[model samples]
Target chain A: MIQKILNEFSVNFHFYMKLLAEHIGIIAVSISIAVVVGLWIGILISKKPKLANYIISVVNIVYTIPSIALLGFLISLTGIGNTTAIIALTIYGLLPIVRSTYVGITTIDPSIIEASQAMGSKELQILYKIKLPLAFPVIFSSIRNMVIMTVALAGIASFVGAGGLGVAIYRGITTNNEMLILVGSIIIALLALVLDGILGIFEKLVLSHKLKKIGYKRFTAVIVAVIVGLTTILVTQKSSKDTIEIASKPTSESYILAEIAGELIMNETDLDVNITHGIGGGTANIHPAIEKGEFDIYPEYTGTSWQIVLKKDENYTNDKFETLNKAYEESYGLTWRGLLGFNNTYSLGIRKELADQYNIETFSDLAQFANQFTFGAEYDFFEREDGYKALMDAYKLNFKKVRDMDNGLKYQALFDGKLDVMTVFTTDGQLSDSRIKILRDDKEFYPKYIAGFVIRKDIIKKYPELEEVFKKLENSISEMDMAEMNYRVEIGKESPRDVAISFLKDKGLWRDKDE
Target chain B: MNKIIEYDSITKSYNGKVILEDFSLDIMEGDFLCIVGTSGSGKTTLMKMINGLIVPEKGNIFIGGRNIKDENLISLRRKIGYAIQGNSLFPHMTVFENISYVPKLEGKKEEELSEIVNETMKLVGLPDDIKEKYPSQLSGGQQQRVGIARAYANNPKILLMDEPFGAVDSITRFHLQEDLRSIHEKTKCTIIFITHDIYEAFKMGIHILVMNNGKIEQYGRKEEVFKYPKTDFVKNLIAMAKLS
Candidate 1:
């Protein structure tokens, strides 16, 4: 285990360091915002006892809320992204800061107050000089605890689409990769340890001094350092455009496809790939990641790349491959590496008996009794215009209820009759194995298309060889062949690289062991 | 010739128990007036009322003919030197800072303030070098003297003390009383002191108020209160205290 950990450290040392630096920068900004806002509130509370009571009560209530629920609540409002993550973490970090500030300032001995007042000092002067100074130890400890919590909460922020070490852990969980999860968790723990060590040194220096000499100079210095340090971290952080990251959606099928394509290109070509999974399927996040230079390449579905990204209705199909090919290139400044010969089309799927019993031969057939049936769909499909939701509106079908299910669980829901019909990808290997029947779109409202590799327009110009590799894969595999490749990786527990090589050898695209 | 302090018809209560009803007193300038009473006799409450720390629920307190009310309460508090049984020094501040506190609060120049602090420290018999230390480092008696120096620093016209010498050793208490007398003579401040020790009151007070329940049974010169014995409560207190 140690050797494995050491090997990971040696290989991805820079990656983890960069990830650490990013987490620190983000967390520092979050904690600073929390502290400033909390302390201001704390000071206000100190002045108005009743306001303090209300704010403290609210913060205490917020602290009791489950972290994931809070993240989910924010995601609904802000959309899944880093802003929601930071805001949620910052809110969680507020309770200790505000409570400590209140406790510390209010608990100073009343006699000291009498002394200050008898000295002709004003109320404000006494608070700043006597009350706050005496309360320093307690307040500082609360801030220290807050810093630790900010680090932990910031890691969880990655769940709501914030990128940090937590991304590695979440991806690790979905893919069942223990090593990746361990590394991510260790980095977070170390970040907390390092922060505590720094603060511990600070606490020692502060408390070691003659408590009397802890006047405005020392107090102001600490505040100044915190402000300057936070600003420096934020100002000097790497922008999205400066580095390359590659993320894929759906932990199983699409991710494997993107990984194989990325590995082939990154090995045969010169670009790098980060290969993250589960960021809402298709070209939406990938397109932006590439445009922002966070990712260099990802596999995107044709209908999604066309209908949604290109903003064209299904009518403009001069050719399924040719129209999408031409449109994406011009519109997104991306090159559609010719089709990989797999159409992961959105099909109206149901259990074989349900499909036969209802005599649902076409999507229009379902519209007659659509209000009586419940549909189960992957969360994103409920919203996307090119997704099952849009097709329902295009064909004027209304379902009794549309429940969101995880990608892996939707098929199970169909088999169990929990869903009357679900939107499933046509090319999912489980469709044939699970005995699910697909209904035809007689109105041609649904688009038939292949999923394939997409790279930035600049990457194609930079590495001309990428076009040849994508072309080779396109010619080498058909829809059934691609489905079989996905089945081996997804269910057969075979690595994508092994699956790719086996497929390449069977098709005579790759040389055998002798070569 | 000396009339720096007086409390007229002072009445206070807590939880419906009359503690100091219809209490009246007077202290001349430079007079060390100690009102001796047992615990809960309202002596501490009366002194606090005189300094506007606690207000009488009934009756008015005139400090320099300005009735002690909201308008001049804080200003009156600043001018009345105050100390309590708790050697309640600001823990974060040094001995010197706690001593010079009042002078600084009055916006005295730092250089002159330091000099005045040094002079007061010497008068209170606190070592000049102890100014650099914090209250936590000092002994109980030393903390109280720093309290005294802080109270005396403002040079207020009236000093209100509630069992100020109660926390120290008898030797330290005697020394503190002597220091108090010398400081009062030099500053000409009227002192309204509270104590349970009748002997200490007789030893130090120009006038003594023997209080029982809520009202004063006798208020007269120390010699008169000692010799005349106006009330049974006063006689019993003197006999119980073994006051000669």
Candidate 2:
């Protein structure tokens, strides 16, 4: 496992560097803002003891919110990507800083304050010279904790379409690649340790009498300059015009689709292309991001777009594609293009041994034995409008137990005997395993989830040639072709980009400019 | 001598418990006036009022014939030095920084502040080598001397000491008292020193004011107060001092 991870690391060194830089950028900006705002609040409450309890309690409450939930909530207001990520991280960073600053100042020897004040020092002077310097050790320790916490929490930022090392972990999970997950985790841990060591040095320097001669204000100015410089460089590095931004859900299938689209666009045109992989909530998040112009295009499904994005209650069929496209264009200024010709519709899978013993070949056949089985599905499937409740009511099936698990882990759970029946996408590569049998959806209750590209209308207008490139992919992939691609990536341990390129090359879709 | 500080009919209380009521006093310039009292007798409160650290519920305090209520307290405090008991030296600051703190605030040039710090340290018998040592690095006696040096560094006309040497050993306290006396004689700054030790007051003060229950029991020259006590509390305090 370690060798595989090391091999993966060497191969993707540049990719890891970009992720590391984004992670650091997020942490640096979040912490800098937290320090300024938290110190002000700490000083304010320290001066007014009556407000200290109330303000600290409020910050404490905010701190108690789970990081993922907070990010999800902020997505509505701040949209997705780094803005929402940074805002959530900054909120998390505040409690430690504010509490420490307040505690540090308030816990100072009262006699020292009396001495400084008796010397005719103004309130501000007493705070800057006497109180802050004395409280330096305490405040610095809390900042260290906050920095480390931010480093770990920033991993979740990738879930909302922000760039970070979390892309590796999420991609690894979705593709069932443990090596990628391990590599991403190790890098995050090392980054935290490195930052902590840097802060330790700073703490030592600031507290030492040698650095005292330099003046605290000047020292603070240098730190602020460094943070501002980093943010500027990172922010300006993202070029806005004439560049295509592509997003992918946290699935190997979505990742492969995105890479194919990106490769084709960059090959066919002079446009710069950047793909953000493994967005956390998949279509639920990527749709909003595309609407807000944070992303220009992403691979989405017809069933998901219709039921979840459009909030349609009616059953969706292949004939409804035009209506879905029209609704998307009218409501969200998004256009669906390039129906990938594969329907990765939701289906049920049972352990092969259990299926053979019960002779459950279809949904109606499985309904009789549903009471004896423990069914498992991804968390989103439980909440979607056309998801768990609707499917259960359609089949009139009631399982003895229903377990919510990650989409990536449901197949593993089924094989492990933890789940007798699990929800599976029709084209999931894991279904190729002999231990699991794909049950037929005889009732045809699930909508056809034809994979396609959802592109912003403005982007299509800007790059008219992109439409032609997308048109080449329409009705190009079959169910067997998609499953083969997924199996090569997941079971064969092949890179998604490699699988996509190879598949496109075999299909005669690869544009050879040199030829 | 001109009256340096005059408190007229001052009243202060906490939780309806009277600390000082209808209190009046006059401190002459260049006099080392030691106000001796037990805890709660309001000696610290009275001295703090001269620096405007404490405000009386009623009455006015005049410093150099100017009403302190009308004075900018920051400037007023700059003109009056203060030191207190129990490790009051700023632990984060070096001895020189602690001593020069007031001078720096007074907008003295860096060189002048250093000179003032040096002179004050020398006056308090601190060696020049320990100038950069933090208060926590120093011994208890050394910390006390640094505190006193900081109070005297500003060259103020009035210096307030609230048992500044109370935390030190007897030998160190005796040395601190002697050094302060010589400092007082040389600077001729009016000093209002509060101590619970009557013997300390009598030994260091030229004018001794004995307080009992927030009121002055006796106010006179040290020799006169020792020779003749006007109240039973003053007589008993002197008797205790003599016995100790």
Candidate 3:
């Protein structure tokens, strides 16, 4: 799997290089802006000592907000891409820089100030000539802290079409391709290290004014120039203005479904269609964009929209599709383009070897020996209302221990025998390759989370034939087809677009217009 | 000689507590005047008020026969040289830069400022090589010399020194006191020197002004202050200096 990932990297080396550059470029621009402006604010507040606490308190509040949520909020104003990313990252970057500047200037010896005043120095002259130079080291150190944070946070910028190495990481996560995740993570880490190392040199030079080393900043600048140059190439490579923008949550099934829709539309019509997934905050992030017409469509689960969006409880119902249809149309002007005939509901799974040992085919059967089993699940599953607690309470099963692992790592832990049972989505690509046996929900513990398209209602109306052509996807794909498609992309080393196109082609929904 | 510095009914407070309340005084030209007071006695406030570093809330100050309030503060400050204790020199600037700063701010040419820096440094007995060194590299005595040189850079007519030797060792303090007295005699400039030490007051000042709790305890020639203490604060302060 690692070799396959590396092969993919080599094939897309230029693209990856450009993406990493854009990532660093975004960081460099945002951080520089933050330092300059944040310092001014710091100096301004320092003059008014009484206002310092209030200003910093407000900035501290901004820092406390989640970066992704902040980005989503900023989208309304900045309207997307590098501008929005830079703005959000700058806000996060300001807190430390401002605080440090304030502290650095305030802490200078009063005698020095008096001496300057005695020398007939103007207030502005005193600040620039004396205080700032003395305060550089403290301020730079704080800026270093902010740089590291901003680099990491810039990964979320990919959601609003801000291209960066985050694209690879997001792709890796959504497809369950661990090697891609590792590759993207390593590059981002290296970029941060290089930038920080350069900053350290600048800090040192500021303090001692010594020629300890030659060409340190120049060398760093060259590397940055190269990254920026390559990034420019990759950014400019974006073509196809005539495109329907489809968005998806960061999930394997969602990505595949969106790709399938895009493939079908591009193949059947003269119009172009493309998917931009890995959106932050999953449904919460994508839903607003779709409402604002920034995105045209995405695949959502019925259970999620019902529980999260409509605020429903755990009562299972067959009339869910009708209620969701009415609410979405009236409230959001969105259309539920019917189910894809697959129910990717939540399930509990154990290694087949362990299941055989315990003779557990159903959740009720596992309940007797539940005390002997150790469970692992994702962080979201632990918090969602219809998640772990509900399932455990409804099933009346108490496991020996429950560990909250990452979504990707959960299956790996179970496979390694670290976990006796783990959470699984029925349509997960990994389930096809693993010897994991999903326990049947004999007690009907989970509500149906049927997968289908949630498109802007206007798009369906504007392209009336879209409603008919899309409804053809209703009851079309089965559970096996979804699992197979996910597996092809996840383990078979095929791209989601390819897997989707192949599936759509086989279903006769994708064909060249000439053909 | 003219009253180069005249403080007229100056009242100032911080957080509703007055530091110098309704105070008035006159400092004559060419007099090495020492204003002696303990901490928070508003001695520093009197010196700072001359340079307009701290402003009086109620009344006006006249420096060199001109009302300080009527003139541009920047030009006023340029003509009024001020110095303080240990950290008076800027740590980031070299001795030369620190000394030349006042001259530069007065719009003197760089070549002229260099001459001023060297002449002032020589006047303060600082070595030529120390001009290139930062204040941090200087010894306590050297840093104090740089501070004095910087104050005299623009050749101000009235110079203020607030406990200038307070932060140095006894030996360094004695050396600095001698250097200051000689510089005062040579320059013939009015000096408002503040100190809590009675010994420094008597040894340095030609005239002594003693203050306590924001009011003048005694103002007279050093000989008169020594022979007759006008207030209990002055008597106790003099007695304490004698004991020390």
Candidate 4:
């Protein structure tokens, strides 16, 4: 199984390299901006030594915020992807860079400062020639530390659609594929090590006055120049094609359905489609991007609009689609396209061992013994409405503890017996993993959540012909068809694009021009 | 001789503590004036006032017949060289860079800067090749000569030294004093030095200002101040120095 997963990476080496560059680029950009801004702030604060402590206190508080919680808070202003990720990571990188800068400058010998002043050095001159040059080693070491930290955190940023190796790792875990996670993690760890090593050499050069006289700093400059040159070439080359952005929440079914739609669109049209998958905060992230026109399309569920968007918790059997479509039009200025004929609602599941031991097959039956088992769930399953809070209240049950596992790791955690129960999507491919058993929702706490395309309203208006072409996808996929597609990509370790293309070919919706 | 520095009734205080009150003095063009004072007697403040490193609360300091408050402070400092305590050299710079720093700010050409650096190093009795060494690589005596060379590079009208030999060993400080005496004779620049040691003061100064509680007890040529003790503070300080 691991070999099959490794084969997937080798087959798509070019595409994965682009993704890796995108990840590291986000981290590099964030660290660069943080160093510049943090230094500026540190200098300003250090000037009024009285204010330095207070400013550092504030930065300390900001640094203490959990990364996931911080990302959730920043999602609204910056939205998903690189903007939000860079902003959050930059905030996280600030403390060390700023502290180093402040301490480095402040600790300079007063006699040195006096000598510089007595030599007729202006304030700016003293800073550039004496203070900053003296502070270079300290400042550079702190920046190296910030870079290593930002690289690790960049993975978490992938959850918000920032796109990194973390995305691949999450996809791996959600699919319960061990090898893919191993491949992604090892690469990320190694990237941090290599970068720190290079910067370490640079720091030593700064401290050695004799080596510096002969232009030893040029060694560090050369490395920077090469990385920047390659990143610029690759990034420019990657974005050279006019691409349409499609986004999806972190789930197998969402990825498969979105991939199918993307494939169908790309096959019929000349447009290059860029799919940003496994987005955190679900529609909370996607709707704003769609409104701002960052994403052209993504597959979204209807019940999310009714319950989460419209804030109506009660499940209405009929008119769910109408109310959701109207809310999208009025509230978000987006359009909900024809359904794919699936309602992938949240459902409870247990390990097969527990299920067989108690003969538990329904939600009501589990409620009696809920306290005997620990619950695990994805972030949104515990955060959003129609999620853990509402579900538990509706069922009038409580588990021993509800762990907020990442959506990708929930299934794996359950199978490993780390959790007795976990929340799963109705069409989750991992449902066939043998170790997991589904529990029927006897109380029906969740609303009808029919899945379909959510497109920017302006998109259809601009490309009117494309709207009709898109309508062809209406009811083209059933729940079982989607589950099968997800199973192929998630469990079979096939690429989402391959699964999507084969599905389109089987349905006679697409044909290669050469074929 | 024309006066190169004059302090006019300077009053300075910090945090409600009076450091100097109505302090005034005139320094001749080429007098080697060493100030001896108890701790916190404001001798350092008086030296700093000549270059506007410390601005007085209620009076003006005139350097080369110009009021320091009216003159641009940086320009005033460029004409008055300063070295203080253990960190006389900029640690990150080479001895050459440290010596040439003031001249570079004056926008001297590269050749001119190097010429001035070499000449000043020689004047301070530092080895020619030591110009390329960082302060950290140099011995304490070598760093002190580099600091003196840096001061001489500007060809300033006055030199201010505050405890410049305090961190060096006695052997090095004695050598540095000999170097200073020779450099002083060659340049003929007015020097104002502060030292806690009575021996250092007597050896370095042509004229001495004996101070206690921010007040000058005696200001005259070393022999005259030694021959006539004006106050009990000066008599006791000199007797104590002789015994030590």
DockQ score, prediction 4: 0.71
Give the TM-score (vs. native) of candidate 3: 0.76
Fnat for each predicted structure, in order: 0.56, 0.94, 0.91, 0.85
Model 4 TM-score relative to the real fold: 0.87
Question: Higher TM-score: candidate 2 or 4?
Answer: 2
lDDT of 4 by residue, B68-185 (tens): 7789887778878888888658888888888999999989999999899878988888888877778888998998888888887899989999988999999999999998998999
Models, CA RMSD each: 8.8, 3.8, 6.8, 5.3
Q: Estimate the overall C-alpha local distance difference test score of candidate 3.
A: 0.83
Stretches off by above 4 angstroms in model 1 are A43-55, A210-515, B6-25, B56-59, B67-76, B108-110
Tens digit per residue, CA lDDT, model 4, A324-399: 7887888888888868777787788899999999889999889988999999988777668657878888888789
Off by over 4 Å in 2: A213-218, A348-423, A432-443, A513-515
Off by over 4 Å in 4: A1-9, A214-242, A318-320, A346-426, A430-446, B240-244
For residues A188-241, write the lDDT of model 1, one tens digit per residue: 999899999988877887676643256647776886797678557655553434
How does model 3 score on DockQ? 0.59
By summed lDDT, the worst window of 10 consecutive residues in model 4 chain A runs over A233-242
Candidate 1 TM-score, true structure as reference: 0.70
Order by TM-score, highest first: 2, 4, 3, 1
Q: Which candidate, 2 or 3, has the higher lDDT? A: 2
For each candidate, give the interface RMSD after superposing the true interface residues on Cα: 2.0, 0.7, 1.2, 1.0
Docking class of 1: acceptable
